[model samples]
Target chain A: MRAIVLAEGAPYAPAPLSASHPLPPPSPDTTLVTIHAAALNHRDVWIRKGLYPKIVPGSVLGSDCAGTDESGRRVLINPSVNWASDPRAPENPDIYGMLGLLPLPGTLAEQVRVPSRLVHPVPSHLDFVHAAALPLAGLTAYRAVVTRGEVKPGDKVLITGIGGGVAIFALQFARALGATVIVTSSDDSKIARAVKLGAAAGINYKNLDWRKAIGAHGPFDVVIDGAGGEGVAVYIKSMRPGGNLVVYGSTAGSEVPLQIPIVFLKNINIKGSTMGNEAEFKSMLELVSKHEIVPIVSSIVDGLERAEGAFDMMKNGNQFGKLVIRVHEKHHL
Target chain B: MRAIVLAEGAPYAPAPLSASHPLPPPSPDTTLVTIHAAALNHRDVWIRKGLYPKIVPGSVLGSDCAGTDESGRRVLINPSVNWASDPRAPENPDIYGMLGLLPLPGTLAEQVRVPSRLVHPVPSHLDFVHAAALPLAGLTAYRAVVTRGEVKPGDKVLITGIGGGVAIFALQFARALGATVIVTSSDDSKIARAVKLGAAAGINYKNLDWRKAIGAHGPFDVVIDGAGGEGVAVYIKSMRPGGNLVVYGSTAGSEVPLQIPIVFLKNINIKGSTMGNEAEFKSMLELVSKHEIVPIVSSIVDGLERAEGAFDMMKNGNQFGKLVIRVHEKHHL
Candidate 1:
């Protein structure tokens, strides 16, 4: 089996690619997934560049994928695996699943082994390219907007950062939930595009006071911040009392100076969410199927050979939505 | 009428008491409460010293008090008064009423005018000193432990600091809610007292590896941090996944370095709560009446004349519970 294995942490310029990997047989309770398409995430880029200190030399870096099992069952892989089972966990799978950060191997190869329960049946209407994009980013947005944010119809939601996969999904999910979606983008074009994608308003964070612009929207019930920093504190101030701030990714920076008194005075709730639980995943998929909300696929690279290029495009910020790697030939499959 | 007034922000010794002023009359829709007792909180001390920049000079400083209205009805004053009302707020006469901060004068005076709705019938069983202690610290603890922490039977709760008014209330509240309470205290005698007050375990945080001691208790479901600093980050790490950390006051100083990834990975929630809402106040009063939870009153000083002495006791950390100022004699009417 051909796999894009990183031997060492190096810049994408060296274009290191290796081809002599053997596909390991599935262990007990593990299902072997023949990868058809895998999507790139910012985490993968960070993992590849060794920004994640735990990444070893032999780590396979992708977390989101869709493919078929040995029995020819189509599925989308849920990539978060936990060793300790929480009874309250949404998915009570028999074995650990694909949580890319831990000891579990990721899905950037031709074939990957995951716990059977982690694989959800993809709707027949959705193809592998779109299905592959739904696990990590989609679940993150789902958890942020629905599960954690508790966004409901008539609620106003403010999503920070446009063009990022999670932000785009958040906009669509908020819209599907009947919320008035507002988004922020540094790029003018991205703001326009976000508005076309059902956003009630889009703020150019680069040119205007995003806090004042978002304040004009006045007291959003929920604010989803992908950009962590002082910006999160600013957004928190824009929420009405009892409003929620769901923080997932902090792409901008992490050290945010916060005024603790304001948080207490306003009675604001700040919740940090990662990707969604399995129940949330199913709920999102159900919404997608019902609403026919297709994930915005920015670009689909032809083969696994161009994995480096796709990652480069992501790093250079030239891509909008998800960049998928089609690993297998349709005729061959 | 006599009042403890700070003509300017200065040291306690330099700040003199003013006694020539007459009691202000009540306005329409408002009642003049002849304050029978006022409790000294850190907020009062901060306000007097002008540590709180928002408080203007000559502003009376106490936020918690119990007194008799012009109609001679015994009442506990709600301190939080925001001018803007949320229509969705619950409907109980005491459900959304508070007098001291905004839209109302501060409570440290011989007589203060409050909207009639801001008054609640004090539990007939509790005296003025106990009722005064109940509003600010008791309500903060009630909201933090019950509303924010959602403590339940068999849940393990970690409370940092023990001798302060809120921490004492938290200890009582957590135990009443059937949670196993663990507390941290620097004072050895305070630890012993906390245990007697229902703390299952106590850690002297002055010692190193306090986290290890806390970790030995396994993961806490809720960690209430009143002492802020790098110590809170340690407490946050001690929480189980999906656990909540309710921060109400920061006595240890505010700026603390945080690891953002730990927050996301553990799915921890950090909520800042001040004194609770009007509903919480009424609910706490009911709990006090039903459960017969008597607030620990350390000392009750006489009127505005000795108010400075009570404040001094609170500032010097000599009091185990609420240091209350008895404003007037019961037979004065």
Candidate 2:
């Protein structure tokens, strides 16, 4: 198997592309997957830089992929594992971790082995590049927007940092659910791009009064935010009483400054959500298939040799959608 | 009717024991209740000190009351109004405000007029004073512990500020639900009182390492918190993944400092809860009746003439239970 493994070095460069890797041993519960396309995520960037916890230097690095299984079934891998079917949380701690990290091999390879239960058929409308983009970000958005937020038709939904792959998916999913989506970003071009992608409104967080913009579009019904900082105060203020604030990541800062009284008085719910359970992954795929929702692939590099450029694009933080790697031609067996 | 009315003064003292006030006008949707007893809350103290919003001069100022209706029905008033049975939230904002404020008459009076729908039968186990304590605090606790927290049997529960009427109620309600209850208080004596009242364990928040004590009892499944500030960090840190931290008040500080990443990874739910709607109020009364739960009353003043003393005790915060005013004999009928 040719794989993308972390390279141990002084600077800790994640050379996620390796030509020499041993094929995984066969297991009764596991099946081999031949990856046709894989996508870059923030997790890949962190693992490559050796910033993620419990880093195994030789571990593969990727969480999202669209590929084929041994029985010749078209599939997409659910990177989140050990969650059982519990929507509330994983059955156990630590074991309910994502793929592409220690102990679990990643999908940025010609072949990978995974538990059979974590595999699902790819949405027929999507090609491998687009299908690769769906596994991680789409599942996250499904849980955050559809499951946690419970966004309804005509609901006003606000998603922050529209440049991230998850935020873009959230916009699409919320829109697919018939919600009026609003977006926030520091980049006006990204805001414009989000508007083109169906956002009802967009605001630049850099504004001295960025919060003022929210009042016009919504006292939003559901707010999907990953930027936790002083910025949260405005989200708290702008939400309707009993609104849900679903969070999956914290790219901006870890400390959230919240007005405690408002949360109590407004009946607000702030939930911490992450990569979802396997059931949610299937539901995510169902929604994607039913809506013919194509994964937003911002850029696709030709092969694993250009993996550095893809990872760099993710690291630089300006990409608006998923960055995919074409591992093989769609016709590959 | 003699009502406890707000005295229009510079240092606005709540004359919560008016000798003579006009009786509330009769209305088609309203029913008159002859007050036998009323309980003092932190809300009463805030209104008395003129610290609460929208104070109307000469308006009555109390929330929890147990009395007899015009039809001689033994009743307790649900102070939360206009919520229209939606367990999620009030159908509209502002109109869902509690009693004892402007536009709504308070319970601290010889007779109070309220919507007939907000009146319910008092639990047979409690006398007037205890029943008075049940309305506001018990409803808040029932919503926090039972509704939002959804505490199940064997769930470990944490209630902070056991001195508070609501927290005490939460402790009792969670225990009655077959949960193992833990309480936190700054006063050792209050912790002792909470233990006597059924807490499995108690920790004094005054201790510099208060959270360390929690490790022995649990990583709590549900934490009912009223005091929010830097202290919330420890509460968040000490909860299980998918734990519910229900906030109904912010007595310590309004700003809560949260570790956003932990919230997302642990899938913690931070929800703001207040007094429940009509349906939850009925359910609360049912639970109280079924369990024969008694409100922990600290002191019952002989009459409204000593209402100041009861209000002062609530403001000083050393009392371990509710301070109530006995307006009339328990057998007023």
What is the RMSD of candidate 2?
A: 2.0
Error of 1 at A205 (Å): 4.0
Candidate No. with top DockQ = 2
For candidate 1, the TM-score of chain A alone versus the native chain A is 0.91
lDDT of each: 0.77, 0.86
Which residue segments of model 1 deviate by more than 4 Å?
A: A6-34, A51-61, A69-74, A82-105, A109-113, A208-218, A329-333, B1-36, B47-61, B66-75, B81-97, B101-125, B204-218, B327-333
- Give stretches of model 2 more than 4 Å off: A14-16, A329-333, B14-16, B329-333
Error in Å for residue B262 of model 1: 2.1
* lDDT (Cα, tens digit) per residue for candidate 1, span A1-333: 666666664643255455756666658888888889999898877776677766677656689889988899998887766533332232333453455554676777788888777878887779999999888898888888888888999999999888999989999999999999888888888888888899988888876576688778867889988788767767877887777888887778776765666666666777878776667777788888888888889999978888888988898875669999898744232
The lDDT of model 1 is: 0.77
Q: What lDDT does candidate 2 reach at residue A90?
A: 87
Interface RMSD of each: 3.0, 0.7
Clashing pairs in 2: A4-A16, B4-B16
**TM-scores of the first chain across all predictions?**
0.91, 0.96
lDDT of 2 by residue, A193-274 (tens): 9999899889998987787887767789999998887768888889999999998888888987788888988899999998
Best by TM-score: 2
